[model samples]
Target: MSNDRFSMCLASDLFRVKKLKSVFVALILMFLILFLTFAVCWVGSNLVSKVEVSETPSIEGETAPTITQEEKDGLLAALDSVINDSLMGSGAICLMEFLVMIITCIFVGKDFSNGTMRILVSRGANRVHLFISKWLTMAILVVAYSLFALLVSGILYAFKNDGSFTGYDFGILMRCFSLQLLCNLASMTISLMIAFLCRSSGSALGVSIGLYIILSVALSIISTVVSLSGGNQDWMMFMPMQQMNVAASAGSYSTDQLCAVIIMPIVYIAIAFAVGVSTFVKRDIK
Candidate 1:
């Protein structure tokens, strides 16, 4: 069993599977939801603007508050939060990560549940090579989807902003995307580890989602405690998703913060990948 030959065969076969095809469709649908949500909000705001002219009746006793320049600027800033490219890109990446988790559960968990993994091992395939190939295939999918989501997000933002999306810097968008991708790759690693280890699709799905929720709540609590203790927020840069969100919102990061963001995700992905591969290699399959 040549490692390269077996890995390629497995990757190719996995790509052609109906389950994988459905994953792609799910990704597309998720993207569409993001795009349509922005479009609908834009249209709804415009309709509300038109309706306010005649329907907003003036009361004889009450005077409306005067709109100040500072207030107007604040409102524009808030609007920018919703219609900005960086925020949209971050949102799309997050949504795709959730979709990928589901796909990963189906991809690896089903193989174990159906005894396909054991059959492949019995046929003389190298376990290490199999793990590496599977990781590479999922990585490719993530990179491709992340890039597409970023582009779609930028286009949608451009349409919202009077068709001038290019006014925003591409470098900023790329930086945000890079941070988001790192976090997503880490998420993929965790998902793959759980799926491969569980050996049951339903259990993998439940565990993965449960773990995410627990982590989120735990991190939030940590952040709150740190804030109340008057500790410097520099330490918060270690939180992967928080770092990614900061990158998206700020449109840039300092050199030290960027290094931390990049290093943390890599450390996580490496640990999970190593553990999953080591365990799978030693396990007996009937």
Candidate 2:
């Protein structure tokens, strides 16, 4: 409970996470995210070049090039849109929140399954401190990954576009990504609850992985019904997938809808804290 104790407990938890090699795996995944971002940027930038080159009429030929000025303008506009979306982390940070959940769940479940939590508690680490420390460790990983993805994508997109840096303010870009961190943390919180309840890595994985499947099925049903009935589909904005999209700037929603979607994650975090943290604090780790 004392500051000294808390600090020591946090340090130990972080060390354990390092030993788990979760951070190593996250580092590898970060490169995969970067690779995907690079591919998208490359393709977008080259599309215009390929079209323009292919349609160029020979100097000897008096015929005009087949590509019209309007068509060229359209391609440029699309490229600009892609660059803007990439700046906001559209394709880059899409799987980030899911990654947060998975890493947290597996580590938490392992701590329980292998008697690590019991050992730590037996050594006088307060359960609350342990919980807080573990959460912070996972938070650090996602925060680092998120920032790296944003920073790299910014430079990558700029480089691909001939060094014409985007007009976006760096500060605003970082600020906009707060929603992403929030969504990821909220997901991590729920996964934490599942891990605590199952107290076994295998079981936790089974339940945690089902999370997306359930959301996908629910969203699909809602979308199908709305399309069939021709009802307003703005309600989907509050669903998990749409909510994540809004966080990642891959979808559009009104200010009201954004506010509503944010509440879903916060609620998940609140419930998880109430149930998971409390149970972990008191449940017999022996």
- TM-scores, each model vs. reference: 0.85, 0.82
Model 1 — which ten-residue stretch has the worst lDDT? 48-57
Among residues 3 or more apart in sequence or in different chains, the pairs in candidate 1 whose N, CA or C atoms overlap within 3 Å are none
The list of candidate 1 runs beyond 4 A from truth reads: 1-3, 16-21, 44-72, 85-87, 240-247, 250-252
As a whole number from 0 to 100, the lDDT of residue 58 in candidate 2 is 45
lDDT string, candidate 1, 1-286, tens digits: 3867666656654564445676768677767876776776666555434432323345557554344445445555655566564345545667788788778887878778887778778877778777776777677778888878877877776677677756455666777788778888888888888887887789999999998788788889988998999987677778755643544554556788778888888998998899989988988764
RMSD in order of candidates? 3.6, 4.2
Off by over 4 Å in 2: 40-44, 52-87, 166-172
1-286 per-residue lDDT for model 2 (tens digits): 4778788877876787778776667667766766665676568757665654434434656564456556767776776666666556665565666666778888888888888888878888878777777777877877887888777766775676588764555554654577776777777777888888889888888898897788878888889999999999877766666666554452455677668667877886788877888988778875
